[model samples]
Target: MKAVNEQEIRASFANCSKGEAKRLALPRDLAEQPWDDLDFLGWRDPGAPDRGYLVTERGGEVVGVALRLSARQRGHLHRGMCSLCLTTHPGSGVSLMTARRAGQAGRDSNSVGVYVCTDLACPLYVRGKKLPDLGGRLEETLTVEEQIDRTRAKLSAFLDKVLA
Candidate 1:
């Protein structure tokens, strides 16, 4: 992934109005983010725990999506896996996040949901920069590059669904 500025990030949003995107919270540590290691920029809003966001490149152009975390609760003993990276977490580490479909469908209240790491750090987890609290780390025969490719593919598919 490439390093992006605030204006680029704000303009990339597809599911929300421009004004809303402008008002959405961006990471305070954006300047310090490890852009080279990132597949996408994702974060949960500090002011609104249920709200999350993701920004990534799609076919050379940036695309952004706003996500809402499901209200359902999970037990700490129950293990959940991120659909994108396959990292397993004991509880709140994984969440059902839904993004409003882009355009008119979004106005109609349509949304697409997927189970993802609650922290929205799938790339970090896949690359071993971050570890899931419960599973330690996933063991796989695929190389780091292969894992990164796979994770990005999953994300693309999810974005495709949202855009559809």
Candidate 2:
């Protein structure tokens, strides 16, 4: 991942209007983000918890998507896995995130949803940079690079579904 400016981030959005992307909230700590360690930049809007954003580089261009988090938390006691990183969490640590499909399908109210870490910090979690207290991290048979590759592939697949 590379460091990106606000304008670049705003212009990267693919699933929403340019105006909406312009108005969407960006992380306040963007300057301090560990860009080299990120597969994507993701954050929940500080003023609007239900609103989330994700941006990743694809084919040398940045692509972003706006996501919505479900209002109610489900199965807090159950073990849940994030589709992106394969990290297990107490259900409360995971949330259903839905992104409106790109173009006309979005206008038709079509969306793609997946269970992801509620904080949307899978990259950090997978690298052992940030640890959640509730659910223990999964022991991995693969190397860190392999795990990162897996995460990226899964997330790219999800993004493809949204754009399809």
TM-score versus the correct structure, for each prediction: 0.97, 0.96
Tens digits of per-residue lDDT for model 2, 51-117: 8999999999999999999898877678788989987788678889999999999999999999999
User: Per-residue lDDT of 7-125 in model 1, one digit per residue for the tens?
Assistant: 99999999999999989999999999999999999999999999999999999999999999999979888889899998999878899999999999999999999999999999999
Model 1: lowest-lDDT 10 consecutive positions: 130-139
RMSD of 1: 0.8
Question: Each model's RMSD to truth, in Å?
Answer: 0.8, 1.1
Q: How many residue pairs clash in each candidate?
A: 0, 0
- Give me the runs in candidate 2 sitting further than 4 Å from their true place: none
| lDDT for position 103 in model 2 | 94
